[model samples]
Target: MNDTSLKANFLSFTGRAKILHMTWFAFFVTFLVWFSHAPLLLAIQESMGLSDQQIKTLLILNVALTIPARIITGMLVDVYGPRKTYSAMLVATAGLCFFFAAATSFEALALARFLMGFVGAGFVIGIRMISEWYPAKQLGLAEGIYKGMGNVGSAVAAITLPTLAIMFGGEDGWRYATAVTGVIALLYSIVYYKSVSDTPVGSTYFKPNKSGGLEVTSKRDFFFYLIMNIPMYGALAVLTWKVSGLGLLSELSANIVYGLLVAIYLFQARQIYNVNREIFHTPVEPVLQYNFKQVAILSLAYAVTFGSELAVVSMLPLFFKDTFLIPMSLAGIFGACFAITDVLSCPSGGFISDKFGRKTSLVILLSGAAVGFFAMSQIGSDWPISLAVVVMVISSFFLGSAAGCVFAVVPLIKRRLTGQIAGMVGAYGNIGAVLFLTVFSLVSPSAFFMTIAGGIALAAITSMFLEEPKNTLAEVMPDGTIQLIEVH
Candidate 1:
């Protein structure tokens, strides 16, 4: 594949490029709806007469269900194809958006936000869709473009929602502003359904052997997969604890919720065992096997990169306004700078991975993110606001780029399991958000930045073990013929 020629054709909306554009736009709409509340949070607080603690809980609730939603979405996309899965998700989340806009109480608002987290899973669908359309050689850039553009949804919300609210000219302006995003989502869902496909004409759309859980090639990986799943549930438990701490749940309710999480984890483990039980009796042949450690390392990498991005985007508007005494609208624009970096940084990360090596690109970006975040930890009220914004942009560049690098490799792990792998990795990113946001609720902003810096540093260290994709991957066709797909 000639990359230069392909790059020239990026603007051509035909063939695989059309799918890329359509899918990314679908993802963009989902994220726009998912985070439509962040910039207008102050208005929400005032409108609903919410407490400070409740406002923070709303941020936490915004990302909570995304953990499981991403996992479930991964399975659904793999089984039903991205076209159907993504369209249906958009339609459902559109209703959730309307419900949130109509909320008159904090409890109703929180419930609506929790359900809206499901929209976050739309990212996983495009990961699978783009991988199916693009060859491995060009996949990094393709996926980068997909994510970089799609992620602008959050930034778009930050930059526009405040103004949209102001234009409506009333206390209920925020409510109307939010409802408009739902209308866009509802309309786009139909457009997306009619305009795209599962794959290019005549291409095979691979399916996993099982649907209940990720299929592992060995017993060790089976257990390792189970271990990795714990953190996702653990993140949920942490959210429950935090909400209970805020008096949102009673002692009995919190304890019961914890018990339910444990039961759910055990049930999931049983399903995993059923899917990979054959591994105990027969080892997977080497040609068809890939390392599970790769997935683990990438998941951790995303936890810090995209995870911190989500957490920061949610809080940065407030952080800037509080620290600099700026107006809410100006603070939101500054916050937009963080995610806007994705336009260049994310695609750059993928392009770098395509040119260099995946492991090298990931390690360098992760290390840079740690340094960038450490710099952010030093920001104070005494510092110039301009300098603070500069620090944030630089840090966001590394963080967004690292996210691009993480997904650049996700599709190479196993073509058939790409959706599931993306789902698990994406879920960890939320887990990172939940934990980091919880820390933010308890500690100062400086402490929150340092905590994220430490997490990224740890992920960088673990990334040393990541194995790069081989030149080709062998898959069995439906007719029992072995097909080798070029990866490098």
Candidate 2:
């Protein structure tokens, strides 16, 4: 589509543009609910008389459940549809938000925060929804706009929630501010359900033949997929260890959590086997086969890109306040600058991927992110405040663009399996956060930045293995006729 047509399409109320609007708003609300506590974290800590370690624990808890939730939400969206899955998630988010807002103790707050991580999985639903509406040629731009804009909710929370809390002007102001976000999410969930459809009229929505796990084409891929799943659980175990080390959980409780993780991993592995066992008996045709390695690499890429985004956004305000001795309000605004870059940078990455090759775009963006993080590692109190803020904004731009580039390749991999693939990749983002944030909890700010830089460098090397998408993908239609979908 030309620029004029594209602008008109975006402005129009009918067709894919409307779906894009509704779906992005759904994602926006989910993110707003998921990170609602971030800007007001200090207020919550003061209100509850929490310790520094407790604050760190809450940040970690915020992302803990998202790792597994993305995997589950992905399957649900693939089987049911984005409309149902997103609406249900929003309802859940509303409840979690209310629970968190009304929490009277740390334990209650922690549980509510953990449950709210499920809201993060809402991102996966929109990926599938957008792929259904857009063609391959225009997919990157569309998906980028959706993600970049939706991500603004986090920035919105950072910028507005603090001010809202101030406006309410009391020890309980943060509580009321947080509750308002839930009410809006609850109302919007109903509105979203009414506004969108699973697919365009006359189009058939594809479902996976099996549920509970991703279906791989080859026996080797089945094993690889299982192996890739290990890190997700391992990240959770690391979080448990970190919390236990903080004296937050008893030894017996930590051990029980560890055992529970092991059992869940085994159960998930069996589900994967059940889903893909048929592949061993009957080999999948080459025409329908895809490389599991692509998924693995993208997962790692997202772990670094979006994962770093989560870990950094969570701690940046605190980092700024502690390191620079700035007021919390100013620190929050600075923290928001990191995420606000998404508006321009994310779409830029997608546009680059669409114009340049996908693999090439990812490599370039990932490299820039590694370098940017390395630069961030060098910042200290001696640095000028303006200079420090500029570095943060620049680093954020590269990281956000890298995230856009990663998803640009996701939908092109396998159309029908987009939800599952997006889910796995998205989960890895949280896994990355858990890993990086765990490192942050243990080390100094400089060391944490360095650790992230190392991880991004490694992910950039991994991106070299990804194969670019082919021109088209073949699928069997409901009428038993072969259909070709453009991918590149």
Candidate 3:
């Protein structure tokens, strides 16, 4: 394609483009609030006189609610629609932000942090919204843009909120600054609700036939789906165990929390079965008969990209402080490279897929990211901190781009179930974090890099199974009229 034609396809925002932009911004605010504590944790520790164990417990609490929250939110988005669901989530998140900002003790902080995890669920909503707007062929690139741009919210918090806290000054500065983020959430909820719709004009929004469950087309897929869900709930059980059962929590609290977690996971499993129960009797026909290979490959791809990032992000500050002898404050500034690269690389990754092809773009990106991680293993003991920072940024570019590569293809598979599909794909990213961070606990930095390389290589081989978008998707309405949605 010529430059003009490529520009028209990518830069077109008159219809879904505007909504894509708006939806990503809504996702951005979710992360901003979700991670608002990171930059202020030190201050919170200082002001609250918390013990090391309490601090660690708080960190565990931050992500504990998100696993099941995303599963439920994914189902809700399909039923209530992404537009309404996203709006309601924003309002709920802003309220959690207020609770967090006003917390004056360890108990309050723990409650607030757990509540904030709900914002992380917002990621699932936009998967459906973006899928509604784009066709199969261009789905990868468009979904990539929506995901990558929205992910920059983590970078934004890393870059801006701490400084905002400093500017405000005083012991309670972090609190006021956090409240400022809450204001953004409250205002944006209004903006997003008014600015976008779930479907474009003249198009009908198709709700899923089953609520609280995923509709499967085959018996094998039904079992496969259940196996996949194990990790989602298992990850939560792990977090709860770490918080209450391990040294982080007292023995008494751990036992209680563990019991609570088991109950919750069982409840969710029941819901999952409810959603997929129809497949046991008879398979449902697909709107577009694409292989699940694309979704499976993308899930593995993100495990390395976003997954490794999460593992590395939690440790980067300490890595800088130890390796380069930087102060805690400066270490944080340097560590920000891991996140800031998303603004560019994620979009660039998607754009490349649009220009070339999905499978090719992902293979290239995963290969480069493997090298980036390997290079990261070799930061010389005598190297200046700048060199290490440069290495991280380069690695982040590939990592962020690979993230773009994954989402660029997410929406193309099943437009109607994009939220559920994206939720599953997106959850693998968190799974990577749990698995990789566990490895980080056991090995040297070099081993961590090597393990990630091995994982990415596996993901690359799986990429072979993804088929490029072609022809048109056949959407059969309940009235038995079929509409052909063009992929070109």
Candidate 4:
């Protein structure tokens, strides 16, 4: 079938497409609950008498746990399958939503937000789900549709929560509004659990060889995997530092958290060593071997694409207001235009990657994003407002599309390892958001755009080293038979 037929199939609820719709809606609900507080932060502050520092702390804490949560969720999904994993997460986070909404103290709110970070890991779960249901020929577009549509949950939250808050009509209206999201989540958990399977009937659900960490083919790749894990821990440390800098945590507490992070990293490294220890003594069969560089390069590219997109989304309103002397409300509309492009751009990127070659599509998309960001850096007060908005939309398309292209290649790496690989790459996207947000805090907006452009350009160069995936992947099935899964 052609792209048109496939896209038409996407609109209907049947077969694998039914699974795709259900899975993406699960993701959509997760994002909805995950970002529910963003639109209501002002009301939350007013109701709880939160200081600016405390509010910022809540935001930092919100994402702090997600860096590790994605990694943990990836492992769980591979072990337990997406159906159980996602349903459990939704149920758990529903309770968190109620807890956050009911919290009377800043400490309670902070704790709730920190735990809610797990919801961000919902993205990784569906990547494995869609890959399980879709063929290599349509995987990119399927994954893209899943992401592009599901991501609108945040926008939906932004649009609807405030109205709901007003409809409730009280100082604690935000609380009521927030609790409704939990209700949605709690109800959807059951719907998702009953509606989906790990894979289609009779299709094998692949699992990693070892449970502790990603399996690698060689000792060198083993070390490389360990090194890649450091940045995730580092991102958490950075959040700790940011909170401490705001005087939300005492220096002693910050030091303790830092020490704990180090200890946890050591524990995780040991687990990774345990999982891949066999590689140290024996070489993996050539047929089972897959390069670790694909994960590394995609992680970097996602850091540039999704990471910058998040950072820019957060600050764009202020940047637009200050640069163009527009009203803050109007600027917010303009800022939102950037993210709105994700709906179309993400699927388009995946389609491009599907129709063309993965490596070539990714290189061009990243390079185009770099150029788009470079164009954004040149925007100034002297430019026409309309022209600036055009530049923002065009640039955002490249960034969003690049992110879609990164994930297009993720699942084809190794069937059993897709969850872990998606987890690491997904986590890096969060790391990028954290690191780039930090840069935004420290530098001029123009400088921030330039920095991202440079990073994306470097990632594009890195993409040249990413070997295209083989036409088929070899997975050992139950009863000791090897199954050749067509990838391309």
TM-score of each: 0.94, 0.93, 0.91, 0.98
Kindly give the stretch of ten consecutive residues in candidate 1 with the minimal lDDT sum: 1-10
**Model 1 vs. true fold: TM:** 0.94
Return the top candidate by TM-score: 4
lDDT of each: 0.91, 0.89, 0.79, 0.92
Residue pairs whose backbone atoms clash in candidate 1: none
The sequence of per-residue lDDT tens digits that candidate 3 reaches over residues 1-488 is 24443243556556778888889899999999998888788888887898888887787788767766776787788788998999999999889999989988789999999878778889989988977876555566677777777887877886788899899998888898899889999999999999899897777776677777666666676666667777776677677666764466777786787677778767766886787676688656665455555666777788778889889888888888887787988988777778777778887888788778877898888888888888888875698777888888998888888888887877666666777777778778887887888789889887887888788777777776778766566666779787776554
Model 2: residues with Cα > 4 Å off, grouped in runs: 1-8, 49-52, 166-170, 318-331, 380-385
Higher-scoring candidate on TM-score, 1 or 4? 4
Candidate 1 segments exceeding 4 Å error = 1-8, 45-53, 166-172, 317-330, 380-385
Clash counts for all predictions: 0, 0, 4, 0
Candidate 3 regions with alpha-carbon error over 4 angstroms: 1-14, 136-138, 245-248, 252-269, 286-290, 326-330, 382-387
- Estimate, for each residue in 299-336, the C-alpha lDDT of model 1 and write its tens digit: 99998898898789878999999999999889978987
Candidate 2 lDDT by residue in tens digits, 1-488: 35553442666668899999999888998998888998798999898999999998898788888888999998999999999999999899999999999999999999999888788889999999998888766777788889999998887887789899999988999999999899989999899999999987877787787898998888899989989999998999998998898899999999999999999999999999988888989998888889999999999999998888888987899999998999998997898788789988877888888889899989989999999999999999999989999988988888988899888899888777889999999999988888887788789989999999999999999999899999887666877676677787
Local lDDT at 61 for model 1: 86
Least lDDT summed over 10 consecutive residues: which range in candidate 4? 1-10
What is every candidate's alpha-carbon RMSD to the true fold?
2.2, 2.3, 2.9, 1.6
How would the candidate models be sorted by lDDT, starting from the highest? 4, 1, 2, 3
As for lDDT, the candidate ahead, 2 or 3, is 2
Candidates 2 and 4 compared by TM-score, better number = 4
Ranking by TM-score: 4, 1, 2, 3
